[model samples]
Target chain A: MNDLIQTGKYLLIISAIAGLLLAFTEMVTAPRIAENNRLVLEKARREVLPGAERFDTLDLATTDDAGHPATRSLSLGFDAQGKFLGTVQTVSPKGYGGPIDIVLGLKPDGAVSGVKIQSMRETPGLGTKLAEGFLDKFLEVARAGHPVKFFVKKDGGDIDAITAATISSRAFCKGIRDGIKVVQEGQTLIQQRAAAPGATPLPGPATTPVAPSPAPAPAPAPVVPPAPSVPPAPPADPESPPPAPTVAPEPPAPPLPPAIPQGGGQ
Target chain B: MNTKELTKGIWAENPIFVIMLGCCPALAVSTSLANAFGMGIAATFVLLGSNLIISLIRASVPDKIRIPVYIVVIATFVTMIDKFMAAFTPALSASLGIFIPLIVVNCIILGRAEAFANKNTPQDSILDAIGMGLGFTIALAMIAVFREVLGDGKFFGIPVPLIKDDPCLLMIMAPGGFFVFGLLMAWKKHLAAGGAK
Candidate 1:
């Protein structure tokens, strides 16, 4: 009993000292760590929305169409002269291996300006290809003012899925759709905050809305002209003939034709 | 203190090649030289700090609770390093990921504390910690060099001449890690035996 008491006493002392040391270290490093994280987020935001001199995160109190509050903050970007550039929002959807965080920038008129992947834990060679230019197609489609399609060609939608990584592709699309929703719902609030002088930020609501299913093509007619326009200019440049043909054919042909045979074989 | 306490960990009792300790991280982070070096330095920092503190409190620590006390000391050091790295070198911290936190359970810090720090004086404990830490670092670097060279055809992120275009990708994968580890262990054993003869 005496030995047990002695052991407990020594352990307690050691633990107490360790705890105190850790607390001291945390006090010193907490602010710096927070700063580092903020810098990383800022860098990602800038990449998605280039030319924005600064950003202001609007505290939107309004709920979505489903009546639940938004979970993400809608950041409004401004130029050097303080003109409104667009809105930047981040959305993380469950990917094949894990959640994929995507940062998307939307033009003031709701066109997609750019997209940057914040972080992902998908498979290295297969699912990770989403970061390597696979997402550029989505950016192009968004810039052309077409409704972002969430499914692959096999599912009666236009977006081409990554080879052998359908799940990751679907997750990436879902994250973009969710980001668009956040931008759409918070647009009025963002405008109001920007217009008013020193507006008090409103707190976000408690419950986050469940993201709704992909809505019917908002404007399908505009998509057809952009598709042909994308291929012609690059191919006309004789200096880059090899790369143009390879790029044009690979994006449209390889995924669709082979997908039918591959799906049937499986 | 004799130099044997210091020199022994480098070759004769290398924490990875000979003593076969901390192999999980040895394989996990050896995919890149930068990661290997970062992990090595972080482990060294923790080992140095833990050994020093444990030695200072060796006598006062009760025998029955020595392990827990040592753990508390080591974990505190690991957490400190983790936070410091995250603050100063966020990119490296992100790439190293979970391995940084796993340093708490490395076995090397605790092993040295129990085998040497507890019994030895503070001066000798510091020396032993340094020797073991270097041994661990060198072992990790060696594995990383071979893995990075053959797997990615790159040396410290620079592409090598002939091998750059068509490198053997398997060398960076899990099976390749086991193969290289086993080969390195065999080579080390061969050298030890030849030196003995």
Candidate 2:
């Protein structure tokens, strides 16, 4: 009976101390952890869309232009003049391995500002390539120079495919294309309301219309190298890219196409 | 109850190689030297705190609910370490993911409290705690060195010769972890046998 009583007493005391320590730990570090996450997210937002001094977030209803339910995002970025610079929103797409989380940025026009790959447990060398190639496509795609609707070659858009890692290329391609479609629809809605003969319109970026001609033909073969190697686009060459570098930084690794190589852009 | 008790944990009762507790973090985070170091420090904090408190109450604690009591004590330290890691080393914390919380049941600390510290003096318990922690750290570091070099073809993120340039993709995969662990275990056993012979 004495032994039992002693044991019970010890248990109670240990339990009380444990509870106190745990509460103290939670109190001390909870705020710091929260701050760290916020800081990192902000950094990622900036990297995804640079040149914008400050930014805000928007709750884009996941409803597609068709008014169907889907994954919506809280958009982040800054407004530079009438144009929304660094406009970024995260989108998750299921890849061959797992869900790939991507941040898509849009410049003033409906073109891509850049892409930030936030999370992926992709196969290291192969699937990981998707996160690296944002620049060539971002600059060229964001320019909206080509009147043709943007599509990754797999979807028949002119965008070239990464050589071996086709699936990652397609996943990234789909994400950027879908993001463009969403932003354009939003812009159109804003424009429609403003152009009404009597009404002063609400402010927003002008939406680009989805082209009647759909994304270009698919790539069954002839893995065209990405823009990094494509004879420097005549203007914004990364080798000596112009003042406001049109090319986003490539992934640290060497360019994709085994055959054609460029000056190592360390 | 003095230094010997503590020193024993560093070698004889080393958690990773000898007792085989907390193998998940030992292998998972041991991919990089930095990660291994982070894990080692985190585990050490938990071990030291838990052992100290558990020893303080060993005399009073009732046998009926001792397991539950120990769990609560262990959990408190785990939370402290987890929170500290998150705040101070957010990058490492993010990389470690769920492994930090799992330290609660790391048999090394709990096992020591139940076996050694409960029976020993406070000073001895603390030493044992420190020793065991160091031993675990060294084991993890050794394994990480092998894994990072062979797997990613890098050491502490710096590229190495031939390997990093045109890597052998296998070392980074899940199977590679098991391979490294088994080989290390065998090597340790061989060394021990050789020393004895």
Candidate 3:
């Protein structure tokens, strides 16, 4: 009993010292770790929506096709002149191994501006292809046009699936589709917010576009003017100084979608 | 300070090959040269810190409670390294993933604390820690060189000339890690056996 007491005291003293050191280390690194995480999120935002100089956090509240009410938060991107550029939405689609966190960018016209996989736990060499060559292919399709039928070719959709990692490919497609829907849901609010900043009357060439009817028109969805489908110019470098404000100011505030139709039937 | 204590761990009692410590990380993180280097340096830092502290407290630590005390000291060092790396080298920290935290359980650290630091002078223990840490790093780099070049057709992510386009994928997988580890261990043994003379 006496020896056990001694051992306990010894362990207690050692643990106290260990705890103090850990506390000190945590104090020193906590702020830096938080800063690093912010930088990572910032970089991902820029990667997905290149040329976006500033971002405003916005929320999208809607019910999915299955009527499950979901709330998604996104970043509204704007150029230096406060012209609305796009929205960056993050979605976690169910992947083969787990939830794959994907960040997607949608132009004011509802076209996919860019897509990036933020984190995943899929098979290393196989499902992990979602981030490699497959990402480039997906981006190409996104830039090709709006209202992309985001399904794998095997599913009678346009995108090509990674040969052996079809599940991850499917998840990528689902993530893109989900992001578009959320941005569409929040389209009206996004436009209002975008317009409030510049406070400039809509230019004669740029009329308030007819808000898209909130009906579930998955294809040819989002009726904002084609805006010449100006492809989102790839930001030269994500880590470099912000792009020059000389961005050819596209007509600000693409049309707003009409009132969100509650529980629009699938 | 005896130089033999330091030199012996480099080859004579090399941690990874002869003593066979830390093979788990040796195989898991050896998929690339960069990962090996990161893991090696992180583990070495932890080893050096743990060995120094344990050796200093060797006389005062109660015999039965030594393991717990040593663990507390080692864990403190590991957590410090993990936080520091995450803060400063986030990229390396992300690629290495859980392997960084798992270093807390590496047999090498606890093994050295028990075998060398507990019984040796602080000065000698420091040398032993350095020697053993280098041994682990060298062995891991050897396996990583083969795996990355053949499996990924790259060295440190730079494409190797002839093999860059078409490389065998299996060399970077778990089976590949085991295969390379066993082959290297055998080669080391053969070299130790007088090189077929």
- What TM-score goes with each of the models? 0.69, 0.64, 0.74
What lDDT score goes with residue A49 in model 2? 78
lDDT of 2 by residue, A77-194 (tens): 4333323353577776666557677777765454566677766655433455465444365456545554434455676665666544567666766666666554443332222211
Tell me the deviation in Å of residue A112 in model 1: 6.5
Please state the Cα-based DockQ of model 2 relative to the true two-chain complex.
Answer: 0.37
Of 2 and 3, the candidate ranking higher by lDDT: 3
Model 3: which residue pairs collide? none
Q: Return the TM-scores of chain A for each candidate in numbered order.
A: 0.60, 0.53, 0.68
DockQ of each: 0.39, 0.37, 0.34
lDDT of 3 by residue, A1-266 (tens): 99999899888888888888889989998999999978887898988887888787655555554666556777878676666777898888899878898988877666677887877766544576688769998888768754467889898777899755789999888887777767665555555445544544543222255644544543333333233232233333343233223222444243445423221111
Using DockQ, give the best candidate's number: 1
Give me candidate 2's TM-score against the actual structure.
0.64
TM-score of 3: 0.74
List per-prediction Cα lDDT, in the order shown: 0.69, 0.60, 0.75
**What TM-score describes the B chain of model 2?**
0.86
Residue-level lDDT of model 1, residues A128-228, one tens digit each, is 66876488776665565455455566665556887557898888877766666555544434444333322223223211122333433222232112112
Fnat, 2 decimals, each candidate:
0.56, 0.58, 0.58
Best by lDDT: 3
